[model samples]
Target: MSPLSLDLSPDLFPALTEAQADPDGPGAHRPALHFGDRSLTYGELAATASPLAARVAEAGRIAVWATPTLETAVAVVAALLAGVPAVPLNPKSGESELGHIVSDSAPTLALAAPGTQLPPALAALERLDIDTSAPTTSLPSPGAPDPESPALIVYTSGTTGPPKGAVIPRRAIATTLDALADAWQWTGDDVLVHGLPLFHVHGLILGILGPLRRGGSVRHLGRFETAGVARELSEGATMLFGVPTMYHRIAETLPDDPALAKALARARLLVSGSAALPVHDHERIAQATGRRVIERYGMTETLMNTSVRADGEPRAGTVGVPLPGVELRLTEEDGTTAVEAYDGETVGEIQVRGPNLFTEYLNRPEATAAAFTEDGWFRTGDMAVRDPDGYVRIVGRKATDLIKSGGYKIGAGEIENALLEHPGVREAAVTGEPDADLGERIVAWIVPADSQSPPTVDELADHVARRLAPHKRPRVVHHLDALPRNDMGKIMKRALTHD
Candidate 1:
C-alpha cells in the first residue's frame, strides 16, 4: 500500500468521516473508544460529536476539561470538527496553574462533561456541558480550515514561569500522525491501548486521534495497571503505548507474572515515550517477554521528530531515524555551526524544521521568534548524537542534562543508565555540581533497592566507572526515597535541591 499522504489539505476531521464509513471493513460498528465499562462505536462517536460541533463552531476558542474519560475525548473531537482551537485544561492542575492558563489563553468558553463541578478558575467562563447521549445532528458541510489555522492552544508545564500556550496548527497534527503511520506500519486493523492522561500530546493527540485517523480502535485502561494492560492485549489489542513509569512497573512484574509476559509477547507493538526508558528496564522486559519496546523522541512543541521504525531493528538506547518530511540536525551549543559528522561521540543540541512543528507561542511573538534560527530550524534545546546510519540518540536536555567537567562535554543520561545497571540501585538521576578541580563534578542521586543495606557511594561510583569510563563516574552520591518526577515519568531535575 502507498504511504498515507497528509499534504493534500488541512481537514483532519474527514478521517473520522471515512472511519465511520467503514472503508476498510465494519469499522463504523467497531468500538472506537472504551473507558472502563463505557464504550463508543465509530458511528456513535460521530453522532455524539456533531451537534456539539455545531454549537462550538461559533466560538473562537474553547477550553476542554481534560479528564481521563470518554467525555474529554469527545469534547476535543467536537472542537476539531468545528474548526475551533481547543485548549485542554489538566483536571489535576492547581488553582494557580489553571488561573494562569485561563488568563493566558483567554478561552471564551469551557466545555466539560455533564454534571462536572466547575473549579473556581473555570467557573467564571461561560460553560457548555457535553451530553454524549444527545441525538446526532447533520453538520453543515464546512470545508477544511486553512492548514495554517490554529487547531490547539496547548499550555506548557510552568517549570520556568507562568505557562505559555503553544499554537499548534492543523498542518502539524495531520503531518505528524501521517508520518507515524508510515513509520509504525499502522493500519485500520490495529487496536491501541493506553492509560496516559488526556491533557498531553502523547495521550490526547497520539493515543486517541492516531487510532481514529487510521480508522482503528482504542481501549483506555482508565488507570494504568499491569494486569489491565495484559488483559486488553490478550483480548486482541494489537499495540500498547505507555511512558517509562508504566514500563518500569511492567518490568518489575514480568518476572513473577508469566501471563503478562505471554500477553506482551502476543502484542504487535510495544512503545515507550514521554521519557527515556532506562536500558536496565528495557533489557529486563526483553529477557522475560522476548519483546523489545520501541522508543520515540518528541516534545510538546514538536509533535514527533523520530521513532524506531516498525520494520527496523529495535535497538536499545536509541530513538531511530527522523520521520518522513522532518529535517533534523545537531548544532553546537553556540547554535551557529551544524555538526555534520555522525561519529556518535560528540553531543550537540538537536534542531529541526518541519510541518510537524508548532506555529508559535500564543501572544509571545518574541519567545516564538527566538525559538527558531535565522535559517528556520527550531532550536529544540535537546542534546543528542547521531550514529553513522542516522539513528539519533538523545543525551539529555541542554539545560539540565549536559555537564561540562574538565573541558569535556559530558551527558548525565549515560551515567544514570550505568548506575541503573547496578543491582542495588532501583532508580537513579545524575547532575553536575560545582567543583573546584574538574570545573563540575558528577553527582548521583539514588533510590536503593534495600534501604538498610544500600550500596556504598564508593561502590556505586566504581560500578559506573567500570561500566562506562572512569571520568564518567559520580564523585558524590545522595540517597533518596524516590526521584522527583512529573506525570509523564520524566525526572524533574530542576526540582532537586542540592545540599
Candidate 2:
C-alpha cells in the first residue's frame, strides 16, 4: 500500500472525483445506495447531484430538514458539490424550533418531501426535485476546490438545550475520509451497511462521506428496523457503522434469525458510536454475531478521533485508543494537562487536537472559543480515563449527566448499566436533579420490559448500593413506557431532565 497521504489537498469534490475514477472508476454504474426497493448507482447519484448542485450554487447556503431517506442523503452531497454549506436538520423538530433554525440559518433554499410541513419562510424557497432515477453520467471531474472552504454545518445534539450548528470545513471531510480509509480499512471493494440518521454527524460524515470518498458503496436504510438491518447483513454488505442502540436492537431481534447470524458472520467490520457502547452489549454482539463491534468515541464538533479496530479485542466499557493524526491529552482537576495516558481510574477532562475537528460553531463565537483550551485543543466536555493499555473509557459527560450526591461524582452511565442488568428494565437514562441538602441527587427514568413491572426507586437504589459506592446509588426513579430518544436513537437526557 502507498504511504498515507497527509497533504490534505483533496477536498470533498475532488475526493468524489477520485471515487468516480481509477480502479473503482468515477462511473461504475454500481450501487450507491439501497433502501428497500430503491437502489441508486454511482452514475445515477452523480447525475442527480449535478442539477441539485447547480440549484445549490444558486441558493448559496441551503439547509435541509429532510426525512432520513435516499433523497435526503444525495441532496446533502449535492449541496456540498455545489460549494454550499448544507445543514442537515432533524425532521422531528417542531415548527417553532424549525422556524428558529431556518430563520437563523437564513438558507437560500430548503428541501422537503411532499406533504411534510416546512417552515413558511423555508417553504418560500424552491423545493427539491424528488428524482430517484439513476444519473446519466458520472460527476464531471473538476479542478481541485478550496480545501479549507466550509462544506457543511452540523448541529450539536443539544445535550444542554437548543442545538447549535458547528461549521465543518472541507478539510474536515478529507481528513476523516483519509483517516478511515486507513484506520477502518475502507476501500473500493467494501460495501457499508448504513442504519444511522443523516442529520447526525456519525451518520452524515462517517456513515456517508467516509465510505463514498473511498469509492466503497453504501447500502442505506430508510428507517432502522431490526429485521431490515438483518436483511442487509444477509445481503453480504461487509461493513457497518451504527450507534449502540442500533446494535442493541439488532441483538434483540437477531437471536431468532439464524440468517442474521450468517450475514453478520460474513461482515468484516461492525462499529458502534454516537453514544457509549455498554460493556454487556459489546460482549453480546460479539457473542451473538461472531463479530466484535469496533467501538469508538466522537461527537458533532469533531467527526471521529478514536476507534477500536476489527483486528483488536474490543475492550469492554472503553472506547479504544485515538486514531492516526489524533492527539489525546488529559487535563487534571488542578488545571494541569497530562501528556501521558492515565490509568483507568484517574479522572480528567478529555482533550483532542486533530484534523477532523470542526472550524467553529456557525455564529456563536463565544461558544466556539469556550469549546477549546488555551493552546487550541478542543475540550471535549467528556470526563474519561485511559487504562494501562491506552483504551479510553468515557466516565461521563461534564454536564448534567454526572450525578453529584454526598460529595462524590457518579456517572449516570454506570448507574444506567446497573439498572439495565435488572430483568424488569428495558431502557434507562440517569440524571442529576437539584436536591436541597445534597446539592444534587441521582434520578432514573426507566422503560419497563414487556410483561414485567418496573423496579421501584428504593429497590434499584438498594441493588446499586450493593455493587457501587453508597453515594453512587440513585435516590429516585420513575417508570415510563420508553425513554425519549432523538432521531439517531441517542437517549435525550435533556428531555429526561426537563421531565
Candidate 3:
C-alpha cells in the first residue's frame, strides 16, 4: 500500500462530524473527558475547538499550558487544523525549565487554563483569551498539509542536558499513529484511558492520537490518581496506557479493589512504556489487574518501534518485538555492525529507521546529523538486546546508565530492576561510586515499601546477591523515601551519578 494510504488526516475529525450526525455518538454525552468535575461531549468539544484554532493561526506557534483534559485535546486539534505548530509545556515544570522552553519556542500566542500562573517568558507573549462560551471564527479551509510542515515540536526529556524541541512533521504524526494503532490492535470499539503528559511523545501520539485515529473513545484523566484511575476503570474502559511509576502506584494502592481488579480483567489491553518496567512491578500489575502489561520501546526521536502484545506473556525485562514497517539493528560508535542475532543475552546500542521517526531537531543540524548512523538508522542511545522470540530487552542508556566496575561493564537498570523485586523495596536507583581498590563500586539508593520497616543494608545486599551476578552486586546501600524523577517518570540517574 502507498504510504499516504496510512496517513492520519487532520481534516477528518470524525469525532466532530459524527457527533453532529448522530448527536449521540458512542461518547456523545457519556463522559468523554473528566478533569475534576468539568465534562464535555464529543459534540460540545468540537464546537469549542473550531474557533480557538482560528485564533491560534494568528500566532506563529500555539503554546498550550493547561492540566491534561479533553479540553486540552480539543485545543491541540484546533491548533493543528489552524495550520500552526502546537507547543505543549508541562504545567508542573519548574520556572527555569518552563522559561527555557518558552524562550526556545518563542510562541506567537499563549493559552492557559483560567487561573494558571505563566512563567515570565510566556507572560511576555501576546495572549488570546478564547471564550468557549461565544462562537468564534472557524479555521480557514486548507488543502492537504505540506508534507514538511511542522505540526508539533516535542522537547526531549533532557537526560543528557537541556531539552531541545524535536520538530515533528505533519506526516510523521500520521505515520506514528498508524504504526501504533496497528501494532497495539486499537479499534473503534476501544476506550483508551490516557494519563501521560501531553507534552511528551509517549502521551501526545500514543495516549491521544493513536486512539483517536482508530475512531476509539479517549477518556482523559488530568493526572495520575490511584483512586480516580480505579474509579474510571470500574466505570468501563477497554485499554490503559501508563508509565512504570503509574503501574507501581496502582499496584500499591489497589490491592483490595476487587471491582477495579475485575474491570482490569475485562479490559482488552494494558500498556507501559517511556521508561523501564521492573519485572516485579510488571508481574504485580498483571496479577493485581489480571492482565499482562504490554511493554513497548520508543523515544521522542522515533515515536514507537516495538511492543509486547496484550495476549502474549510479557517476558520479564523485554520491551517486545519491533512494530511493522520498522527496521532495527545494533551498531558500534564507529558505525560497523556490532551484533547479528537475537541471542536473548547480548547487549549493544539500539538503532532504528522507520516511517514513524521524526524529521529533525528544530534547528540543531549538528545534533540531527549525529543522531543517525551512516547507513541511515536513527541511533536510539539505548543499550539493549533481542531475545530468540525477537523481543527487545533494554539494558540501559549507552553513555550514562552503564557503569564500569572492576573489570566488568554493568547495566545500572539491571541492578535497579532486581532491587525493585524485593517486597520491602518501593523503588531503587543504582550508580557507580569511586573505589580506591576496585576503581568503581556499585552504590544503591532505595525507597522502602514501608517507612517503618526499611530494609537493612545486609538485607538489601542479600537480595541483590540472589538476583544479580556476584560482580554486579551493590557494595553500599542507602535508603531514601523516594528517588528523583522528571515529568515523564524517568529516574534522574544523572543527579545520582553526580551526587
Candidate 4:
C-alpha cells in the first residue's frame, strides 16, 4: 500500500481539506463526533481546532487529559494540526503512575476540558483549557513536518518498571490506519460507534482518529453499554468496536433481549481487540445475531500488526494475516526466523518491521535500543503461532503466556480458550508454576458460573486433557469469585495465586 514508506502523506488528516473546499458541502456539515448530547460536525471541528492548533504550536509538547469527551478529541486534533506532539494521560492512573508519566514525558503544558480536575502531577504543569465551542478562524493545514518526528508519547502499562513513553511517529499513525482501512474496507460513509477511553491506541488512535482520518463519524456512548450499542447500530451506525468485556455483556443478555440481538445482527462490522475474545463469547454472539466478531492484534509500541480482513474468513481463534505494508515473522527461541508454521502448532516470539512502529522509548535509550533487533525489527514480547495460510494466533505474552510443561511448549491462551468451553467456567486464565520434574506445571484459575459448586480440579484437568492433550492439562487449579482484570478487560495473571 504505497511501498511501505514513512512518507505517508504531506497532510496527516487529509479529510480536513473538505472543510476548505466547501464551507457548506456535505463533507463540511457531516457529523464528525458525538459524545453524549454533544456533537461536532467537520466544519466545526476544523474551525475550533485551527485556532487552538496555532496556540499549541508554540507550547512544545503538551499533555492531554484524555477523557472520552468532545473537547479531548478537539485538543488532540489541534495538536496534530499544529505539528505538536501530544501525550494523552489516562484519568484512571494512580497518583504515583501519573507522576511517573508527567516526569517521563516532561510536557510543557497540560490541556483538558475546562472543568476537569487534573491530579497533582498534571496540576503542577502550566494548564491550558480546551474549549470545544470557542470561536475560531480556520487556517489551512500546516506543511508536513518530519514523518519520523514524534507525534505522540504513549505510556506503557509498566509490567516491569515505571511506564516508558513510546514515541509514535506521524508515519506510523497514517500507515496503520490506512492499512486497517484496506483490511476493513473503511470509508468516509462508515459511521463508527464505540465507548472506549481516549488514552490507548485501540481507543484513541483507532477509535477516534481512525474515524476522523476516514472522513466518517464516531458516536461514543460516553461509556459502553449494551443499550447504547444497540441504539447506535439500529439507527444507521455501520460499525462497532469494543473490548471482550463489552461483548461478553452483550452475549450474556442477548438471549433475553431480542431487540439488542436484532440490532447487532444489522451492523456491518463488530470488532474486538485489547485482548483475545473468548471462543465461547464469539460463538454465543454469532449464534444469537449471525455476526462474527473479528479480532486484531497490536501493542503500545506497534500500532497494529494484524487483523482479520473483512472479505476473509472470520476465524474464531485467529488474529488473521498481517496488514498490507507490515512484515511479520515468528522467531524461534534459538533466534532463527520462521516465516510459516510447518506443524501448525509451533510457537515463537512475534517480531515485526514496518512503518507502523514507534521510533523509540522517549528518554530511555538503552530500553529503546533493546526493543529492536540489530537489523531494525521490533521484537514484540508477544508470542504467536502462524498457520500455513499466514493467519496468526497469539498464544500469550512471551514472558507470561508461554508455559514449559513436561518438556512441551504450550501457550496458555489455547488452554484458557479450552477451559472457557466448560459449562461451569465463566472466566479462565492459565499460568505456569515451577515444577521439579516437569520444569513448569500448568495452572488454571477459574471464575465459575456457579461459584457454590465450582468445577473440581480433577474434573477441569480431565476436561482439558480430553479437549487438548495430557501435557496441556492443568496440574493445579485455583477458583476465584472473579478473575482479576485490568481496565481493558485483560486478565491480570500476575495478580492471580494459589495462596
Candidate 5:
C-alpha cells in the first residue's frame, strides 16, 4: 500500500500565498519577520521572495547556507514558493561534514546572502547571491509542488556515521504546522520570539515556518540574550520559544533580574525543547516567575509528535499528549505495542505513524526501510513511558539512555533528575560501564556546585538511593568542570568514560 498523499491546502504555505495574492490585505502591513533592526512585512516578503524563487525553481536541488539572518529566511521562503527542495547547511559544520553533505545531496546550486563568504565545500556548486530587495516576476499559485515532493532534505547529526538526509515532503510540513496551531490555539494575532539557529527543525520549522503558516509574526533575536528575551516579551511578544540552555540561563538570572522574570510572566506561552529542561531549572523558573515552561517532543524526521497543550496541565517531566493528527505508542523490544494501562513506570521505545512524518531517508533505501516497523510505524528509538493521563515522559535514547543492571532497566534521565535535586550537585549525566557482578554498573558524572568541596561518591550515591531505588544509584562518580553538550544542550554521553 502507498502512503497517503497529503492534499491538505493546495498551497504548502497558505499565509504567504495569501499575502502574495493580496498584497493590500488588512494584515499585509503586519511584520512577517524581525531580525535585529531589519524587518519584512507579509506583503513585502511575498513580493521580494516570488521573483527570486524563479532562479531557485530552476535547480534540481539547492543548498542553502543557513545563517541566522533575514536573508536566509527569505531564501527558504522563496524555495517553498518555487516548490524546490532546499537543503539547509549549518555554517558550523566542519569541512569533512560539509563535504559529505554536499556530495551526498548533489545540489545543482548553493544560495546565501550577498557578500557572505562561501566555504570550499560549497564552492563546487554554482552559487547564487540572494538580494531580497532586488527581484521581479509574476507569482504562481503555490500548489506547484506535489504533496509528496521533498521540500527540505534535513541532514541528521551523523553521530554514528556519515549523515543521512531526511527528505521532508510538502505534506509533512503542512500537517505538522496545522496540528501545532490546533494544539497551541495559535492564530494571526500571536507574535513569536526565538534566538535559535536556522538549520535544525526546532528553530527553522517550528520557530520560523510555524509562525508563517499561521499568518502570525516572528521576532528573531539574531543571537540569544537574556536582555533581548526580556525586551521582546515586555514589548508584547505573546510566545517565547527556546531550548533548555536558554531557559536554564533565564532560571539562573531570574533572581537578580526582575525584568526577565516579569517578561516571562507576561508571555502567554513559554516553550522549551531540543533537550530536556532539567527538572531543577524547571522548578526554579516556575517558583521565581510563576510561569511553567512547557516541553515538546519532536525529531528531524518527524517534525513534531507530541506537546503539552496550552489549555492542558503544564506538567513538568513530560512532553504532554500527541498532537491532534499524530498517532503515538510505546513498543517493547520484540515489536509488540504496549497498550496495557500505563503506570508510567514501564519504559518502551516510541513508535508513531502520522501525516507529519517524513517521506524517506534520501538515497538510503535500506536505512529507511529498517527505520519503520512491519506495520509502517516509524521506530523513534526514544525510550519513554506514558502516564495513565496520556502524557509521555522521555527517559532517554534507547542506545544510550537505557542501562541494564542486576535484572532491572534504569533510565539515566530519572537518575540525573534525582541528582539535580541535591543541593551540592549543579549538573549530572549517567552512563553504564561494564561490571562483572551487575553486568553493567551505573557511573555518574558530576559538575559540582562547589568544585572546591565536591560531594563524595558515597554521599551522591546515597542521595540517589534515597530518592529513587538503591539499584539506580551510581556505582562510581567522576567530577568535571562542565558536562560536554551539543549546540542544542543535549549532553553527549558517548564522550564520557569510566577512565
Candidate 6:
C-alpha cells in the first residue's frame, strides 16, 4: 500500500487520490465500480460527482434515493464531496416509515437517478436528478467543515418507536474506515465485491466507502446471487462482504458446486456482519472450502466497532477485539456497574466509547442523551460475553434475546446456535415465552430442513438439552415455513407470534 495522510480531512473523496499511485492501483484509469454490466472508472466517478457536488454544496442536508445503482453511489459521493450530510432513503421502505424519515430529517432536496419514479412521501420534496453522463467542469475545493459536522443522517430500524435518525459525523466515518483498513489489511490493490443495499451502514459505509477510503475498487453484484458471487470472486475480486443469509445460501450450495467453493476459497477475505453467522453455517462453509467466514460487529449508530483481524485466527462465533481507537466495555444488565473481568461466561450489555460513534440522534436530543452514559460511553444495548483473550461473543439484544427465567439470566443466541446444529433444522430462532413455572420458558422457532419429516419438539428439546444446559433447552417448539428476517438476515424475533 502507498503512504497516504491519515489525518482527518474536510472531504473524504479527495483522499483516495492522495495515496501513492501504483500503475495498476485503483485510481483514475482503474475500474472503481461495476454494477451488472455497467462500469465506472475512478476518473469517470470523480467527473460525474464533481458537478453534482457543486450543485448540492449549499443544500443543508439532502435525501438520497439509495437504490443499488451507480447513481445512488455517485449521489452519496457527491454529497460527501460537497460536505453535506446525506440521508439515505431505503427503496423498500413503506409509506409510513418513509414519511417519518422525511418529516424528521426535513431534507431540503431529494436526489435520485434521472427518470426514476419516487413515492408520494419523497415526491413532495424538491427532486434533483443525478445524471452520471452529464458534462462536468472543474471540481470545487472542500472547504473546512467542522470535523464534528454531520456527514450522514441514518435512521434506526424503529423496533421500539418511530425510527430515530443517527447523526453520523465526518470523524466517525474516517475513524471507522481507517480502523477497518488496519484490521483487514485493505489496500488499493484489493477489489471488493458485494450486493448489499445502499441504504444501510453495512453496504454503503463499509462495502462501498471502505474500499474507496483505502484506494481500492468495488464491484456491486446488483443483487446477491450465489452464482454472481462465484463469478466475481473467480474473475479477480479479492474480498467478499455479506450478511449471514448470503453465507447460509453459499453453504447450502457448496456441496453440489465445487466451482463455487473453489471460487470462494481463492478470495482474500470473506466477511459476515449485521447479525451473527450461526456456528453451523460457519463450520459448513469451512468444511466445504478450507476458509472460515470472518465476523464483525457494529451498528447504524457506530459505523464499526470490532472485527476479526485479517492476521488473527478466524474464530467461529466471535466478533474479534475492538477496532483501533475504540474503547469497549461490558456493563451489568442493570446498566449501572461495569464488568471488570473477562471470563467468557458472564454476559453484559456492551458499551463503547469511540470516534466511530454517531454525534446524536437527529432532532431527538432526549433519545440521544438517554443513549449515552454520564461520562459519554454509548450504551449499545447489545448483550455480549468477552473471552479472556478480549474477543466478544454477542449473545443477543438486551430487550429481546436476554431472558431472565427462574433464577438465571440466559442468552437466546446460544440456544439458537445449538438448534441450528440439528440435521433436521434448517433455521432456528429462540425467544422467551411467558411460563407458569419458570418466569419465562424457552420457545424454539424452527424452519425445518425437511417439512415432511420435521424434528419434533421433544427431539429439539433433547438436542438443545444435550448440547447446552437443560435450563437453556426449549420448552416448546413452533415450526415455520421461513424465519422473518431483515435485509441483513437478522431474524426479527419480535415479529414471531406466541400464544
What are the runs in model 3 whose C-alpha is more than 4 Å off?
1-5, 8-36, 133-140, 333-335, 435-439, 449-462, 497-499
- Residue-level lDDT of model 4, residues 1-499, one tens digit each, is 2233333764676677677556677777888989989998888898888888888887779999999999889999998888899999999999999998988888999999997888888777999998788464577656567777788899999988999999999989999998988899889899999999999999999999999998999999999999999999999999999999999999999999999999999999999999999999999999999999999999999999999999999999899989988989989885556646645689899999888999899989999999888888899988888887888999999889999877788999999999999999999999999999999999999999998899999999999999988889999998888888888899988898778
Tell me, what's the RMSD of every candidate?
1.9, 3.2, 3.2, 1.6, 2.7, 2.6
CA RMSD (A), model 5:
2.7
Query: How good is model 6 by TM-score?
Result: 0.96
Those runs of model 4 whose alpha carbons end farther than 4 Å from true positions after fitting are 1-7, 134-136, 337-340
Model 6 over residues 154-249: C-alpha lDDT tens digits? 999999999999999989998898888888888888999999999989999998888877767899988999999999999999999999999999
The TM-scores of all predictions, comma-separated, are: 0.97, 0.89, 0.89, 0.97, 0.97, 0.96
**Residue pairs with clashing backbones, model 3:** none
User: Which should have the higher TM-score, number 1 or number 3?
Assistant: 1
Q: What is the C-alpha lDDT of each candidate?
A: 0.88, 0.74, 0.74, 0.89, 0.88, 0.87
State the lDDT of candidate 5 residue by residue for 237-267, as single tens digits: 9999999889889988999999999999999
Model 1, position 482, has a per-residue lDDT of: 94
Q: List the residue pairs that clash in candidate 6.
A: none
Clashing pairs in 4: none
- lDDT measured at residue 403 in model 2 versus the true structure, 0 to 100: 64
lDDT of 2 by residue, 1-499 (tens): 2245654664564434544553246454566777667767666677667666765676778877667677787788777777788878887777767776776677877775556666665676666655656455554533345777778887775656566888888887887777767767777778888767788778878777776777667888777776666677777788878887788877776678777777777888888887887666766677887788787888778888778755566666778878778888877654455746565666677889988889988778999998888888888878777788788877778775656677776667777777777777778788988899998988888887863656787888888788766787888888787788776677877766544
Residue 169 CA error for candidate 1 (Å)? 0.8
Error in Å for residue 494 of model 4? 1.0
Candidate with top lDDT is 4
